[model samples]
Target: MCMAHKSCVSEADSAAAAAALFAWGANSYGQLGLGHKEDVLLPQRLSNFCEPGCIKSVTGGGGHSAAVTGRKAKPSSLLVAKNQGKTCALYITSIGSGNVDVILQRGSPWTAGVLIIISNIRRSSLLPPFMCLVCCILLLYDCPDGGSLFVCGLNKDGQLGLGHTEDVLCFTICKPLLGCPIRQVACGWDFTIMLTVSGSVFQWGTGLASSGRRLCAGQTLPLFLTAKEPSRVMGLEDSTAVCVVAGSDHSASLTDTGELYVWGRNKHGQLASLAAFLLLPQRIDARCFQDEKVTAVWSGWTHLVAQTETGKVFTWGRADYGQLGRRLESPEGQKPHKQDSQLTFWRPQSSVSLPLCCLTGAAKISCGSEHNLAVISDKCFSWGWNEHGMCGDGTESNVWTPSPVQALQSPSRILLVGCGAGHSLALCQLPALSEPCQDVKVIYTLQADTGNPESQNGMNKERNRKERQSVTSTQSNSDRTRNEGP
Candidate 1:
């Protein structure tokens, strides 16, 4: 059983410096990676990252954190930046002791210039004894090398891809997947699935079709979706999938062509259907907007959201807790609206309103266990499940409609956004300015030989002087703050 997940990258890298920050929740077993067992309600920068060669990418599991860095290339000696221009490198780092284990690698043939980190966590009961076992297991995979599928966590239903349903505490290499190279893996609460470079889907873990109804509970071995029979999924054969994401009971896929497909538990209309489950992939049809194309897909515990190429956002499935971001009025409105019964199969629904329709450019989108977030034109907006202030609106009110996060107002420019079960993460881009030095005169001698007299005389000298002074003040302020430290 193989489990895989995908994340987006921010495109603001420079030759000089870079930084990565994280925040987490539910840290009973030290899974928050804060070097402590307390849950954090706000974003906190990881300690001891003041060095130059910092992190480049980060991924979070149930309770564990993983990062890829460029620090290994640099020697132990601290290389100071000349002219205040810092040279950056990458390094892999972690905190805490239990629940999950992370590994980082650089100079890979497959990814070439890319840096990758694989994170694996062993899911177990929250009891003290179980927690200790999980911690011990996390130590083994502190660092993994080469291209291999690392398996950890609950194997009760073969979700660990170990060919058995026994619990696994340590990370184990996956068996050869029928000689077919596995490019990625994804895990549901009790199931695991893999996708090959050829766009084939293989699944293992509980609730599979095998077991002759007696084994109907779950399986402990890999099962091909097209092995003995054809999958009921339509329009999947020709589509080239770029990524896959899974929820507790459902999963979603985004193709290279920007098409979205979903399957699994449909209760609460999550599958957009009236049936109980979709045994196959179902393409989401948004009507007249079919050509819009989906650039990203995020699956939550009981709901799903998709971002289109035109910056139009659409959500369907569960709306009970307002995860759909659709406004619901009382039954006594101008026209009575009937609540659709819980659906079990895949059906299409529309969520476009004035605000969403007016949105022109959306760069990224992420979904929490129940909430939804998006970075539209470098601005942040959130909706659904704000009980713990995960929406970052400075309040715990649940919003049934999309609302801009006020806490992230002026000074903070959000470069990237990520959403976890009940928490959120943001990478902010601070303004850059140079230090104030001796004011050297930038002489602009007028060319007396110019044919036009107006060209020789400086146009709007007062305006130009004022602009230069304003720029100098901003640069001086920025320099002072940088020297003072973050």
Candidate 2:
């Protein structure tokens, strides 16, 4: 189920501005796109969406916002009738639980578009109740031409691929894509990129993995690269990828050959001793681990996690915060105990440890800002930061080892899992209504916002005003109520 905010508008100019500013969830750093650096307890109007002949879109990030707009026009026939009539078109889209209302001086506004929300789901209601909350969303679009927009990560640089640098509270189409037909899109924190069916890759946004500098702070255009010569990634020739996943500053691609290639940032050993940042993809050697057939891979800010076809997980990179889930004893004077008796007091190789033993039966995994979670068949486990009760163990302490989240100890079966900077979400298949089913419960323990209860209530009042506007119009309220998920 989903939780969202709602809004509505009546003026064209006001709608144009309102389409540019809005916020939901945590607004620390103005990431909600509300044009301010304050937390919004509830949905409130960032601006009015009553502009005539206006085209607009908005998106959200970890702590930032983005928006786009274009010229507007009225239908010629409608204009002729309005010369004797009085009516205008209103365009509206809902992202998360927040409602977006846009006014246009034209024919009927596009009724079919896409909606994206950053929220979460629970994997199992049977687990013991804990406070960990997952963040993700649903993507509803009407691209009848068989096109799809891939949504993951935040746009640190217009890289959410929504054609703007603003945080997208909802799903916005990647506009004006040309030449190669984009089959999928992926995002790193400050960058956005796309892969085409023709084996070509396009990239935009911030940071040069090679120079360690910004390639383009915020890009709206797609830049194509020829994976030949110096720009070519190793071991990708004649190979096609089936899936791609991005982390905070890195990315990974899975080939049809069951091979995995990774690129981008490597601080904290996320890239397995590749010193400098990788501008091109490099093949991962699965033979180094017991599992040779990798079925899935995931990443966090500074670490890597992957699952094999046999339900095994392998992790590398930063162990700080236990992101890697590997056991490590504090070093004694910068040296570790020697396990080999053949060596005579020799220094151990500077190598990162891999915890192949700890990650058994893990079918899926997710990484938060500083923590990690894994789903083993019907059960879920978490490690790392618990500061906001993200670990779901009902404590504010951090765990350096993997621990089962007792809060999820219900009888339902979990299907999917996701994580935000400090929160987590799971999707579970509950028992049918005819059977004994439990209500899907959501728990929030993130740092609470400091604000007067009256002020918070006032925000809700504004949200109610917007909802009333939407009801007065012909748009369906079903879009606004999608946040009530299970």
Model-by-model lDDT, in order?
0.49, 0.46
Model 2 TM-score relative to the real fold: 0.54
Q: Stretches of candidate 2 above 4 Å error? A: 1-176, 197-200, 209-235, 332-358, 431-486
- Model 1 earns a TM-score of 0.62
lDDT of 2: 0.46
Please give, for residues 6-82, the per-residue lDDT of candidate 1 as tens digits.
12223433322233344433454454455676554334444333332344444443444444444543322212111
lDDT for position 361 in model 1 = 65
TM-scores for candidates 1 onward, in order: 0.62, 0.54
Task: Evaluate residue 389 in candidate 2 and report its C-alpha lDDT on the 0 to 100 scale.
Answer: 46
